[model samples]
Target: MSKVRTCPACADGAAAGDSFCEGCGRTLPSDIRDASVENPDSVPTAPQVSLSGATPGPEHDGRPGLVPEDGPPTAPQVSLSGARTSGPDTLATQPMRRDSVPSASGGPSPSTETARSGGRTATSAPTVPAWPPPATGSVPVKPTNPDLCSWCPGRVRTGFCESCGRLQPRGRDHVEVCAPGAVGVSDRGLRHRRNEDALGVRVLPADAPHAPGAVVAVVCDGVSSSPRSDEASRVTAEAGVTVLAERVRRGEDPRRATGAAMTEAARAVAAIADSPGSAPACTFVSAVVRPDTGAVTVGWVGDSRAYWLSGGPSASASALLTRDDSWSEAMVQMGMLSREEAMRSANAHALVAWMGADSGQIDAHVSTVTPTGPGAVVLCTDGLWNYYPEAVDLAAAVPGAGAAPREAARRYVDLALGAGGKDNITVVVIPVPGGGGPRAGQA
Candidate 1:
């Protein structure tokens, strides 16, 4: 006989293989039954797609608009911005350039000026196209809703409604990327109408001349206060991931590749700026993971961070690997204040370094670690970390090491939402090779 399950929403009995509760028509808990048994071969699978959304892709299986059991949600119909549904798209080679440049940030100044934050002196400069720099090209993204006007049938353009002049959700209000060796999720959070955050992740195969298989994950958080911040973050992340993947595939050192990637990303972002005073800006962070060697190299410009979550007996203890280039962190580093006190100050989150046309001296910091055991690498924007700022606490909250990267990342996003997601949240989870069991010290 088939088993029965209780619906969490309506307290009604749901028969085996039922996906929706008959009583309330609500989605049944995923554990109710083996969905595959209902339709063994009808599962939705990701097809080749592109970031530009110019090519046609496969449609989702099952009911129209309904998300497949194991697949990410599909984009709503009538996407004005032409958002693509989440899928594993091909990563194309992009040109990259390398050069030394200055990076800096502080208060929003209408004109170029010198400022000191966290003891770093920087002067804003005009946007230029020449500074030599750097896509995991065309990873698909799924938006939360359509950009239709509520008052009329007209669609939303850019951000304003076409017929009623009202504001609507941006194309990237929500996004998910499930690559070969890593997975990432980005959401616009509760407090932000626009998702000023972006992500790019790719898994490179081992067929390259002299390099091992690797996974590249990049996250950028746009300076929300700046104009076109969303565009800045998106371009920066795309450039970083694309350039890093190419360099790694060419057998370049992870550190040098990371710095080179940052330079290119900075140029990409700077190109969007109208002037130094009104430049779009964002924070950048990346992780390059080589499973063969258990090597993880991290690179960063601002506060976005990478964390090592040791899961097995052989792995190193979970820890934060990158330092923030913020006023509060600088003060703490200089022995001017306690960590708690520095964080409490009003200017705590003021950025001392960032990527933009105006930022002076685009100095990228790189760190490397080779773990002996099993673990997972986490790359995230401040949105997720602002809630669980400590490494131990974050490691305790994540799923077991054996969990799939996509599901694990989904859990983190859900946690942030439950805790009142106040900022745009973006997170990527890349598992270290050879993890044989559950995550270590998981509470």
Candidate 2:
């Protein structure tokens, strides 16, 4: 004869032998029912059985005791022993909802355990940092044509400035028929009444190479003190350049060609001197470059000079060649007087040898210099060098002249003018072919 119990869920009275409530179909509290029937005297007191501070019922299947059904709803006394609970109060703080719990079927529900156990609290979403502050000031923009000449502005018919009539080198009117690699600059200084003292010409073979490295530069400076200096300078430049080109075409050695050219120039000056009302003398410097072999050969008479400049401590205006038919230079070299003293001597301008019939002996000094590396050759009359007291000063001006050949010439002329150009001024800049390296075929 088992005692009966009431279901907590439905309050349906059930027989002790039943495992479920007949009215509500809820599961029976087996532990509570069993304990009540087995030990009547051991009935839990109200104070101990109440949910406010309840005592546990008998253990079943090694689980912690559950509260008696007759008492107020109490929390189950969870024990160290392994046990699972399904009471409403036991799951009150859990995240899982009652609907989310699986039926009797053995599968997990969609319940995620809260991460509050290890003392670490869960955080919300993350944020990104902002970009750095804007720049302090605006960036400067460079002009597109930085090399444009300020003096000769805008386009003109002859590639010269229409406003000032200044000739622009490499302008549309300037012809570039010289050897492809050959480039130079020429200009007349301010003191000259006429710019005819300076002459430059390029003569190409019938079948000339398209590249610039094979060009020849012929530069002649007329004697300002002489009446026919302009014509003498022109003949020397034209004849010398032509003769050199003819020799190159004939496959003659560059050194020999330079010598021949100098001879021809002397003859041309003499022919002029023989003409009526002709100046007896003119000064000239000529250079022929073979880019393929990196060779430079030069010839000179009078006080004109040739200088080689390179990219080292030794890169200076090394007077590879010069002509000193002038009395001052000869006096200094002959130990008659110191160079400084000779320069100021009364007979400084008097010449013993020059390109004219009156020169008595037409002696020319031809010389060749192999560059230490990439370098430049400068040929000029005393007009330009007189102002440039130092060689480095002249070297520094080359790159500043920009790509405009005439601009470079203008720079030299302007410099000489500023230094009080007392006579005709002329300058020619010839860039050595190839990059920085030892040159071949140079003496």
Candidate 3:
């Protein structure tokens, strides 16, 4: 009769030729088990590797206080014939070493067996080590707004849908700002993932300086290639408006205040960069419309633009206020390329100047225009101009007299979105006094 084989730890029976105990998944010793004989103190077993990538002593059970006080436990001397073990614990509790990994052939390879039989041990360095069991505890759940994501039942966290793995719409994805004398709209165009454009508009109080009813507006377009460009544009718009309002309140010249606002905006954008390589960048355009004197001062960097649309029917004339700091414009100005040729070049839209830490010393182009008749001051990013491409086309699209500034601004944004919205769009509309629109403070 074949002798019965059994696991020493669990006292479970093992069939003939079986290497592991089925009861607890423990390594089975090759030696026979019989009540007539006492079990051996030490049995040859597979080498074990610790979490620290080191070979542990024979008595190392990973539990503290097991080591003798005198010195480290001595390793046992035994012959490796059939049995192999990963550690003192059964396979259910202990992670297997990489070298003794289970194979299609049903057991360790011949080479491994040879090494073991020769009293040699080996260890494997797996690319990823086993991790400890997760701590057991109750976790607090945070309350969430279920309606944040439309496509998935999962909650939206940090602008992303956790279940569907989709990007969630942000607050700035579409924004509208309405003030007493100006209205602005910004949107994440159809083709972009988020809105990188920002707008700020404010109408000076009735008791303020030279231009009491002056409207201050700033539009910034984040450079798509820069990291956190959206943040750069937002901070720039905010800082520009704050400084412009402060300077204008102090009775500063419209042109000088616009320039100072640009300078302050540049500093704010520059401070957003955490390092030289990741400097957030953007294009800036600001307009200050003084309805009292019919004076409009525009300042700009990069390709964002400002335009003055003369009041009247759709056929009314319009003028481009700020010059673009773009490669095409620079080429045309230097006579290096004709207007049509420059526009056709691949670098046509490349910015020659922008607001960022890397962009040194910004000299904002400032211009003042005093229109005799009523008109509207429009400030926007290229997203809107790329569709119209001309002052007259944009002027024709503006709502006629008596249209609320907010309505006009929304109309312009809708026009851009209807045109495929290949990029982020932003537009600020400030009706010049006598422009025939609703008076100041009208929503």
Q: Write the per-residue lDDT of candidate 1 for residues 254-362, one digit (tens) a residue.
A: 7678878887898889888887666778899899877666566788877888877756444555566666766666566556767677655444565666787766553
Q: Write the per-residue lDDT of candidate 3 for residues 170-226, one digit (tens) a residue.
A: 456566665767777776665555567887776777666456767788898887545
The top-ranked prediction according to lDDT is: 1
Q: Say which candidate scores most in TM-score.
A: 1
Estimate TM-scores for all models: 0.61, 0.54, 0.61
lDDT of each: 0.59, 0.45, 0.57
Look at candidate 3 and tell me the lDDT of residue 379.
Answer: 92
Report the Cα RMSD per candidate.
23.1, 54.1, 33.2
Number of clashes found in candidate 2: 7
Report the C-alpha displacement of residue 128, candidate 2, in angstroms.
62
Please give the lDDT score at residue 224 for candidate 2.
39
Residue-wise C-alpha lDDT for candidate 2, range 304-374, written one tens digit per residue: 66655443433322223344445554555456766666555434444444565544433355555444334
**TM-score for predicted model 1 compared with the true structure:** 0.61
TM accuracy, model 2: 0.54
Looking at model 2, residue 441 earns an lDDT score of 26
